[model samples]
Target: MRYESIVRNTEFSRAYRRGKSYVSPFLVTYVLRRKRGGVRLGITTSKKIGGAVQRVRARRVIREAYYAMGLNEEQSVDLVFVARTATTRVKMQKVEKAMRAHLTAAGLLSR
Candidate 1:
C-alpha cells in the first residue's frame, strides 16, 4: 500500500524527539502519533547499521512488513522506525517480525 506524503520538516521530526511515549526493542525503536489518511512511516538507520546497503535493506524490510500487515486504514498515524545495531545481524524475516511485534504492542494492530 502507498503511504501518505511525508516531508522532511523540522516540526514533525522535532515532535518525535519531544514525544515521551515510544516503543523500543533490541531491533527497532518507534514512535507513533495521529496525523490527517493512512499511517506515514519514517525510518531512521544510523551509520551504525553498517553501510547504505544494510540500512536500505532494514528500511525495505520494515516497510514491507507494514504493508503485509494490511494496516491501510484511513486513520492518519505517523510512525518513525529506528534501526538498532542488532538489526545488522538479523534477517529480513526477523526485522519484519520486530516491526509487527512493536506495532502490535502499540495497539496499532487489532486483527
Candidate 2:
C-alpha cells in the first residue's frame, strides 16, 4: 500500500529532532505521533550503503517490508525508516521482523 510520504527536509528534520527512535542492526526508525492525520512515511539510505543501485534496492526492500506490515493509510503516526548497513544484506522478511519489533516496542502495532 502507498503511504503519505514525508518529503520535505523540514519534515524529516522534525521527525529526527522530536520523534522517538528505535534502532537495530537492520534498521533505525523514528516514530512521531500525529494528532489528526494519517500515517506518513520516510525512508533514508546513506552512501555508506553503497552506490546508486544498492541504495535504490535498499529503499525498495524497506518499502516492500513496510507494505507487508499491513498498516493502514489512516493511522495517526509518522514513521521514518533509516537503512543501516545491514539492511541491504538481509531478506525482506528479516527487515519486516525488525520493523515489527521496533513498532511493537513503541506501541504502534496495536491497531
Candidate 3:
C-alpha cells in the first residue's frame, strides 16, 4: 500500500519485538496488527550491506520485486524486509524468491 501507513504504524516497535522470524538467505520479520484495512511494507538494509548507495539499492531492489510480484498491498501484514550481505550482489529474482518463500511460509501468500 502507501508508504505512510508502513512508516507511521504506532505499534511497530512492539510488533517488532514480539514477532521476529528468520529464514535462509534473509531475515524475515513482521507484525500483523489491526490497521485501517490493508497491508503496508517496510524495507531495511543495514550498513553491513554497504554504504548509502548500497543500502538504497537494496531497498530499491526489494521494493521493485515486491511491486513486480504484485504484493505491494497485503491485508493486516506489516512487513519489514531485511537484507543480508549475501543479497548485496544477488539478482532481484533471488530476493523475490526469498521474500516469496518467507511470505508463503508465513501463510500470507496463496498458492
Q: Please give, for residues 10-68, the per-residue lDDT of candidate 2 as tens digits.
A: 99999999999999998999999989768899999999999998899899999999999
Worst 10-residue lDDT window for candidate 3 reads: 1-10
- Hey, what RMSD does candidate 1 come out at? 2.5
CA RMSD for every model? Answer: 2.5, 1.3, 2.5
Q: lDDT value for candidate 1?
A: 0.67
Better of 2 and 3 by TM-score: 2
Return the TM-score for each candidate structure.
0.76, 0.94, 0.80
Ranking by lDDT: 2, 3, 1
lDDT, candidate 3, residue 53? 85
How many clashes does each candidate structure show, in the order listed? 0, 0, 0
Per-residue lDDT tens digits for candidate 3, residues 1-111, read 354346654655655776656565744556454557577677777798989988887888888768766754647666777777777688888888887877777777776
Best candidate per TM-score, number? 2
- Where is model 1 more than 4 Å wrong at Cα? 9-12, 18-26
Query: lDDT tens digits, residues 1-111, model 1?
Result: 777645686635764675434454535544456655567767777898889998887777767766777774776577777777776666667767777777677677764
After best superposition, candidate 1 residue 74: deviation in angstroms? 1.8
| Residue pairs with backbone overlap in model 3 | none
lDDT scores of the candidates, listed in order:
0.67, 0.91, 0.70
